[model samples]
Target: MSSIPVGKGIPVDHVVDNTAEHPGERAPLVLNMHEFNDVTTTVCRVAESRRVPMAWYVAFVFSLGLLGFLGFCIAYLFATGVGVWGLNNPVMWAFDITNFVFWVGIGHAGTLISAILFLFRQKWRTGINRFAEAMTIFAVICAGIFPGIHVGRVWVIYWVFPIPNQMEMWPQFRSPLLWDVFAVSTYFTVSLLFWYTGMVPDLATLRDRARGKIRQIGYGLFALGWRGSNRHWHRYERAYLLLAALSTPLVLSVHSVVSFDFAVSQLPGWHTTIFPPYFVAGAIFSGFAMVVTLAVPARELFGLKDLITLRHLDNMNKIILVTGSMVGYAYSIEFFIAWYSGAMYEKFAFLNRAFGQYWWAYFIMVSCNVITPQLFWFKRIRTSIWGMFILSLIVNIGMWFERFVIIVSSLANDFLPTSWDVFIPTWVDIGTMIGSFGLFMTLFLLFCRYLPMIAMAEVKAVMPEADPHHDDHASDAKDEEGGANS
Candidate 1:
């Protein structure tokens, strides 16, 4: 095939059929075979020799401001104590736990896309999985902050660990909070290793293409002397596959453990057997929305629209719709169980969640999570960059409210009418919540500046040229015909 120039004037029908091995597969970028090598190199240039673009600088500076605000709030929180926030008798676990669950839920989509989808051989994940995993790490970091501070008297927070002390006080092995400590920490550690391990080859590529000695050495340390030899590739591939296998179970269990925080509780709205599945679905739903929220902006700012394509956005929207539906089903089931079991407290708790003082929260949760995502069913809406970005943000807002409703609404009306007290957030509560975003964005910005945003090695692996029989299609067809004649 002759090399046809791909330009602004080039038509979609003009794309070269290099995907012969995987016929009928949709190309995320729609590059012709002639453009593949150059385009692939262009994709990695940001990590190689490219200078910092103006937009990245602006974003990084803005995120740094948020990071500074986060620091101030945390310092103030430590100095003032938990009393500074809006914690009362019933709402003791209100906004802090709500933010914890919200951020943790936001991290779930990364593992789902990276480990689970890879295990299922989904090639589409190759483009976005790297940064999604990075976002998960940042999110888990944000998630941990609220709980650590909420423990109040942050200096003695180490008491939760299994370490021995002079008083012979051991940590409770059965606590859901303890379970969250173990679960979130383990997920973060495994995810970090998984992400860095996947980046080694790409890091090596960057190292080889480094323009200066300092650049080469900086990338070299993480590249681990990767020579890209067959032996090196063999070991790297096995380790990655092992990590992927391990992470799949961790992804499910981590959120299940998070759900235990609610399910193990005897509180009327909290003690449901269906919580594990419900939380897991909601986590993935929210996580995908957050991913789209981050990815849409980053792609445009970095000229990465070709890599993170409209198709990718569309597919992610579909996930938001599906999981949002699951969450809706869980809501219906919870209401049904409340009425069917003749549990007045359970019935009253849910009714109060929708109709009491915090009715606005419940409405926001339902509208944002369940109703808003249904817009993605329209192809034009899902495929539009601005449309996807706005909807994704809406989903994020809805998911946050979902956690708020679960934590605050339930606690605001406990078993005894006398014990019931309306929960309200103070500035400290609001500031800490807002600051967590700053912390999250700070880490994510650093990631984009220093590391390969997309998984260059994996992306290339999924390309049409990576197939062994890519160029021998016609010859293979002839061989098959000859064999059949025999």
Candidate 2:
């Protein structure tokens, strides 16, 4: 196959044709793309197209229903009381805290992919980073809700903050709960800024391509006067780099601090040195799984298979496998530590998790979080889109259960057997949990409809034509065009 010319007016059809001819060849990260403009066109087409996919409408309607249901649940919760939940004497923290931790963990993969991978100069991140970043923001939004409302007295929720008032009330500085307020809020702020900063160049592209006044103004306002000049590019790169570096530590620290909510407790299962790393690993594990969950459907629905190719999915699966292994190891080590500490209470706690009244939840957690991911070791499974998609869903379910097992089990069967009782969730608990998913999907679907899903500028930067010598090829093509015109 002769090298395809890189310059404008050089037809790129042969590039796709040649790629098709060689079926077994290593696939390009951005498949079916030879021209720089193709990346912009392919991505922008989704947002700019007049006719939306029927599936998107179906999904949007479904998501809206769930969002409305979430609103209803919140209204009821606020109107009634915290007693509407399944919170008992032993299990004061049930679905609310469980959902909070689960959503927070869900947001982790976005930062890890956006910040950590960016700092490492991983090019594969380009195809999916926008999705992950959006997910991080939405997931954090969902995560933030539970903490605010979980307290019975929603009116006094401001007490969680360090703000002073006429009464001279101050938040408990040493409390892990208060730390969550700072950590989650800070993480959300940085993630939101990081997400928007990266979208500016792409927003400018949309502004330029807009055929209507509203689109031009809407996209233009957010584009921040991006002119694609050398100075603009330089400043954008510098700011993006700084934000990426800033976001990297938060990926580890945010989740680790979240783990402190449990680890700092003196309860048998909750108190442990391993919770920090263990929680971080599980967060990434579940986070990447969610990216897969969202990516598979979005790519399929939006005709983005060429951009978010199988290689990207496969790479994400490998990360899931690695992190899932770490999670499984953490589970085992928890039990080992319990035995090694020479404490009967700790041993009982570990044993109780595996073989207690809530044994079903633990089994599901292990099976979904631990055993299911092991299937990715097979190349066939991870490479198959549906296989990985299904596995990703299972992994997320297991992660939720993992949080449930950690919180509910530990709290339910504590020191005194007489005080121990099973916590049964009300209809409100189940509805609220499902409603959060609705809220996440609804925000994500709206983003897909309006914003550029793929990072057009970043994707183009990674293309072969972006290489330095590609300009020489363009010069040759230009000379050929000049001769033909003459």
Candidate 3:
């Protein structure tokens, strides 16, 4: 391993092993300390620049417009009724729940990257964890909107909460629907805490580097008095580790509860034992796809290829392949289980999903989620920016259609012919979903503009300089001490 300098006053021999360079000429994760600091300054300078970049302004404007439209849609829905959404008999949970599940699934990647990877001591996570966690927060916000408004009378939306109301009702504990409410909300709260808590040191870095007092105080307040003191870092590391541990199970539980919303139901296509792990795997797949989809452009826009690195993108693509294959395996198992059980409804539901009126959706899901991702098995595709972006989008599309197939197909023509009806989403359904995209982009754009998308301090911590092995001053002290003390 190559020797590297470490944190302030830390001895050379005490350096961590994680900072060791790869054998046989692997490229460095970062260039040099000056270059690393320059990258940090460049990110902050984007926030401080008096002139907003033209491209960013255009995107932000469009996102804000969509948000306005979303607001209008909600107001109109409240004034009119749920009738605006095209939801009808047997298909009450159409686009609304579909969007809800999709966004929630998108959020899992962030927490998984930040928490699970941290626990495993994956050093590469420092490059993208901040960006991914921010995405998680925004994605959850987008997700929460669907369920909140799907209640129709938006005024009474609070009824979902277990508040002792005028009606004296507690939310049903047995219903997975109720469990979903708790799961998603808990996920959001913890994610937000974890995201913000992780940002403090980076925020202080910005605060210290701020050119103007306005920027200084603004970053300072968010920095929460972080001063890079050894004691402060000690507590910070402990807290961060604790949060990471707590967040892992919380992240896992959110999607598991979401799957239970379907698995607990007696409906043939919906009810299945495999749904928990299946949903969690699919969530991570879609989440990584979304991250790749966002990061490829971001690395270009922010001029951050050195920090984000091709290796990061390559690793993420590998995950996408793994999880996408898991999802496909679940699909096959569902089919086999349906056949093996000899239950007519289950069997019919499985056949109908692949060959019934909604066969197009099922096939689309298969193509997008399963077939397209198989391209990444080739190193050429995984490393290509354009290839990653296009395939990521395709995966996202397929996952959405996967949910559509499950939600609409099963309900549209179930065993009970009397209750069966084809579910069709209205203009509101389409618009609202579009608006959710708008909302997601809006938050992300603002985050990129104002916050350190990469965790600066965390990145520094992993840099070669922070490894005491490279600090000759510290190394000499140890040698001298050994000779003198002996």
Candidate 4:
């Protein structure tokens, strides 16, 4: 194997020996890294550098423009009321709700990567977990915006809370809509805490290495005085494990509750026992795709290809395949259940989704969410950088259409044919949806620029050098000492 200098005087194979001779041996999770300090240097260099990449500036400016457009759309909605959206009489929920659910699903992969994989001891997660976690925070932020603005009375939004009011009215506790508030809010709070807590060590590294007083103080404040002492490491591990445990249930529950927004409703298409699990699967499906979508450009743009390797991309693609299959199965079963029930309303709901006015949307959803991911069955596609990246984008687009088909199609043409109407999204609706992507990218790019994009401490833990047995000097010394004693 070819060697690389991980640190001064520390030389090791950048890529582990996984040739035909070592069939049982595992490949390294972190390439181009063998020393613990090298991991720190590799990750921290991006945040500490003064020369900004032109790609970052270009992306930032474009995202900022979208964010500004989002602000304008929201402001216009406030002034003109919800009528500005393409929402019609029966289709009261359209792009706003679709975007809300889409963003919520986008957030799920982060917690799954950080918490679930951590619990299961999936070491490959070290490369992508921090990125995914940050994505979760930003995505949930985008998701939260819709619920606040979708309600026509934006000023009276506080009424959703249980605070005492002059009218002596409290929020309807039994409402599924109210449950969403608790579920999403709790998920965001826990996720934010988990993301920040994991960053504490890396933040401290940045704090210590920061060139200026302002940077040191900024990173130090959030680092919470994290010293690399035995006691500090102990507490950090304990806290991280606890937060991971706490976050595990949120991954399944948050989206399940989000599904409850539709499942609990009396509408034929909306009411179903399958939505909870189905939504959870689709959430993970879309979430992982979003992670890959970000990871591809991120790895390329930031010169992190060595840290975020093809193996990481391949593993994530495998997951996208699994969840995409689940989503496909859910789609098939929904149609089957509709047929088996012999309920005309349910039957029409499923048939209308495919043959109705919005059939094009349904086609796009199935094509993107189901057929696109199936291509990953080929090893060549999964390993190909451009192939997986394009597929991931397609999956995200399909997932968004999935939400659109579920909400708009069902609501647009309900049991009462007299009330049926075609829901056409106005420019405002399209722009707002586009603008949420702007908001997500804006937050994510800032995170990449200022913060440690990868977890320094965690990445080191997965390196070959972390194992005491892997040190040649220690082994050689032990052998020499044994010979002398003998």
Whose TM-score is greatest here? 4
The whole-model C-alpha lDDT of candidate 3 against the native structure comes to 0.85
Report the C-alpha lDDT of model 1 over 107-186, residue by residue, as the tens digit: 99999989998888777788799999999999999998888988877887898888888779988988998988999999
The Cα local distance difference test for each model comes to 0.82, 0.89, 0.85, 0.88
Worst 10 residues of 2 by lDDT: 477-486
Clashing pairs in model 2?
A: none
Candidate 1 vs candidate 2: the TM-score winner is: 2
Candidate 3 lDDT, 1-486, residue by residue in tens: 223323333232332221233343223444333335656775676676778667888999999999988888877888898999888888889999999999999999999999999998777788889999999999999999999988867887788888888988888889999999899999999999999999998888888888888898899999989888999889989999999999999988999999999999988899999999999999999999999999998888877776787778888999999999999999999999999999999999999899998999999999999899999999889888899999999999999998889999988878887988887778888889999999999999999999988888887777655554644554343322111000
54-85 in candidate 4: lDDT tens per residue?
99999999999999999999999999999999
* Cα shift from native, residue 326, model 4 (Å): 0.5
RMSD each, Å: 4.8, 5.4, 5.8, 4.9
TM-score of each: 0.92, 0.93, 0.92, 0.94
Error of 2 at 67 (Å): 0.8
What ranges in model 2 sit over 4 Å off? 1-4, 7-27, 471-486
Please name the candidate that would achieve the greatest lDDT relative to the true structure.
Answer: 2
Worst 10 residues of 4 by lDDT: 477-486
TM-score-superior candidate, 1 or 4: 4
Q: Candidate 3 versus the native: TM-score?
A: 0.92
